[model samples]
Target: MRLLILGTGGMANAHAKNFSAIDGVEVVGGVDVDPSRVEAFNAMHNIPHGFGSLDAALNWGEFDAIANVTPDSVHHPTTMAALAAGKHVFCEKPLATDYARAIEMTEAAEAAGVVAMVNLTYRNVAQLQKARELVQAGELGKVKHFEASYLQSWLVSKAWGDWRTESQWLWRLSKKHGSNGTLGDIGIHILDFAVYGAGSDIDKVFCRLETFNKAEGDRIGEYDLDANDSFAMTAQLENGALGVVHATRWATGHFNELRLRVYGERGSVEVQHRHDWSKLFTCLGDDAETGKWTETEVPSVPTNYERFFEAVQMGRTLEPSFRHATSLQRVLDLSMLTDRDRREHEVYL
Candidate 1:
């Protein structure tokens, strides 16, 4: 498979590495709005073609698929363009800035009859996949409660600024670019994982969001910190499950910790996805007297990019489907309103 990468960001680099790792895949070219970024990626990967504009690369028409790693704001247009051009597309998370746009992108892909996938990388984790299987197979019967939290300390420090401080990373802060803040970034991942792992679809969501840390005095970023840094939500699922999702960039000791727990009639499962170590723990059955909890070990495995590529190649539905992705975006879009509603001591769902 020949691929064209649409952005030269860190996530784009990760995607390139994964595709390059596959034997039959070739990264034919890359395009970035920044000429320097395009040149750097070209030099780093020894890519055959590099263009400073996506339009130019699209006109080249040398790739079978387009990796739309552009910011969330442009995801819709970029993916639509790829689909209209009859190329398969793989986009980064939060499919589009909003649910409507995501729906439009999905419609375009469907109309064009091309494969489209969102890079919700966690869906590819083997342990998480196993958890989903167990839940689906009734190993964890009738999931009743679910919760997920993704914590990162990067925004807790003063040195956390990167592309987020520039217009280059549009939508990283502004709701217009997408839904404002952490909800769009890491929160969507947690929500997607929770809903997917529990084998359910969220029917309703009530959330509260906060922007405790802004780009104020002595801060480390250039753009206005107009987005939330933390959020919490309660959701009702289609499978009669109740769930909560919490995400924050302020946890001091937590650096990229994505944790999930689900409780059901038969058993409960917990997942810890972190660097240095990752594990899955299980508690089977309930005890009143001895209060015993059975612990089943979950083995650590390799990263998820490989599975994403295979799914796309095989033309199968990957976890965190566009339908699920759109639901997550809706929750994020609603969270912005929750922030304002709570300030007035009002609850909004």
Candidate 2:
């Protein structure tokens, strides 16, 4: 598979490295609005071609697929263009800035009959994958409740770098810069984590989002740090399980972590991915009687990058398809409404 990496930002490096490592895939080119950045990225990855814009790359049109590492707002336009050009796409999360645009992209991808998928990165977590399998197999009989969270201390720590002066971090804090704040950013991951691990779709959601002041007068040059810093959500699963889902950049101690606990009548499961390692624990059979949780062996799974290559080769989309992402975006869209109206909202998809 010949792959063109879009955006050439920080995440784009991961895309280029992972795809280039795949035996059948080649990171042929890269596209970015900044010529120097794209040129540097191409040199770093040993790629042969670099284009200043998506249009230029599409006109060159040598790649079979594109790894869309663009900002949240740019996903729609770049992805649509790729689909129109009959190229398969592996897009970054959120799919689009809003549900309507996500639906349009999903529908267009389906109509184009190409392999289109979203990078819900956590799907690569072995523990998450195993927990979902156990739940589906009735090991966790009839999930009744779940608690999930995605936490980061980027706002309070320089572990990831100083967000105050960085464009990469500042863009995520401004709505005009195409950010959905904490809810739009990491919220999607936690929602997917809880919903997918519980092995059910979200039926409804009640959300409360908070935007904490990070700067004096709440203005950072051209950026307004008004995007949400924290959010808490109550969600109902289609299978009748109730779950609490939340995420925040203000989580002081943690750098980056995703944790989930699923409770059922016959058994329970817990999964955590922190600092790149993952572990799964379960309470089942007689152990459930004593509430004793034991660690379960979780096998490694293929990463989303590998899966996208496989999908392209097989000519069929996989689990984290644009359609599935659009479904998740519906919950996210409704989450904003619920926060604004201060009421619960039913999720349609």
Candidate 3:
């Protein structure tokens, strides 16, 4: 597979490295609005071609697939262009800024009959995969409740760098810069984590979003820190499970963490991915009687990058597909309305 990385941002490095490492895949080129950045990305990845824009790269048309590491708002147009050009696409999360655009992209990918997938990075966690497996196999015996959270201290700590001065960090805090704040950023992630781990879809959601003041003026040069910093959601799953999903950049002490706990009539499962490490625990059978949780060893699973390559090769769409992402985006869209109306909203995919 000849792959073109669609953006030269920080995430593009991971895309280039991972795809280049695949035996049958090659990172042939990179695209960025900044010529210098694209050139530097090509050099760093030992890529042969660099284009200043997606249009330029599409006109050249040498690559078989595209790794879309573009910003949340740019995913729609670029991905539509790639699909129109008959190229498979692996896009970053949130699919698009809103459900209308996301559904359009999803329909386009379907109509184009191409392999289109989203990079909901948490899907790579072995513990999350195992937890879902247990729930599906009835080991959890009908999930009744679940709680999931995506936490980061980037706003409070310099562990990830200063958000006040960095464009990369600031862009995520500004709505005009194509950001939906923590709700649109990490909220989609934990929402996916909760629903996927519970092995069900979200049926309804009630969300509350908050944006804490970071700077005195709440303005950082061209970027306005008006985007939400935190969001808490109450969701009802299709399997009759009630779940709480939330995310925040104000979570002090934690650099980056994703945790989910699913409770069922017969058993309970817990999965945690902190920093880069993941662990799984379960209370089942006799252990459930005593409420004793025992840690379990989970086998590793393929990353989203690997799965995308395989899906393209096999001519099949995979989970985290454009359609699935659009479904999640539907929930996210309704979440905003729920917050606005101060009431729960039913999710319709």
Q: What TM-score would you give candidate 2 relative to the actual structure?
A: 0.99
Off by over 4 Å in 3: none
Q: Is 1 or 3 the stronger prediction by lDDT?
A: 3
lDDT of 3 by residue, 1-349 (tens): 9999999999999899889888999889999999899989999999999998899999999989999999998999999999999999999998999999998999899999999999999999999999999999999787899999999999999988888788989999999999999989988888889889999999989999998888889999998989999999999999889989989998899999999999999999999999868999999878998989999998899999999999999998898899898899889889889989999998965
All models, RMSD in angstroms: 3.6, 0.8, 0.9
Clash pairs, candidate 2, are none
Model 2, runs deviating above 4 Å: none
lDDT of 1 by residue, 112-205 (tens): 7777777887875556767777889887788899988998876555444544454644346555445458887888788878887788777777
Q: Global lDDT of each model? A: 0.75, 0.93, 0.92
* Local lDDT at 291 for model 1: 40
Q: Which should have the higher lDDT, number 1 or number 2?
A: 2
lDDT of 2 at 167: 93
Model 2: ten consecutive residues of lowest lDDT: 291-300
Instruction: Score candidate 1 by lDDT.
Output: 0.75
Each prediction's TM-score versus the true structure: 0.88, 0.99, 0.99
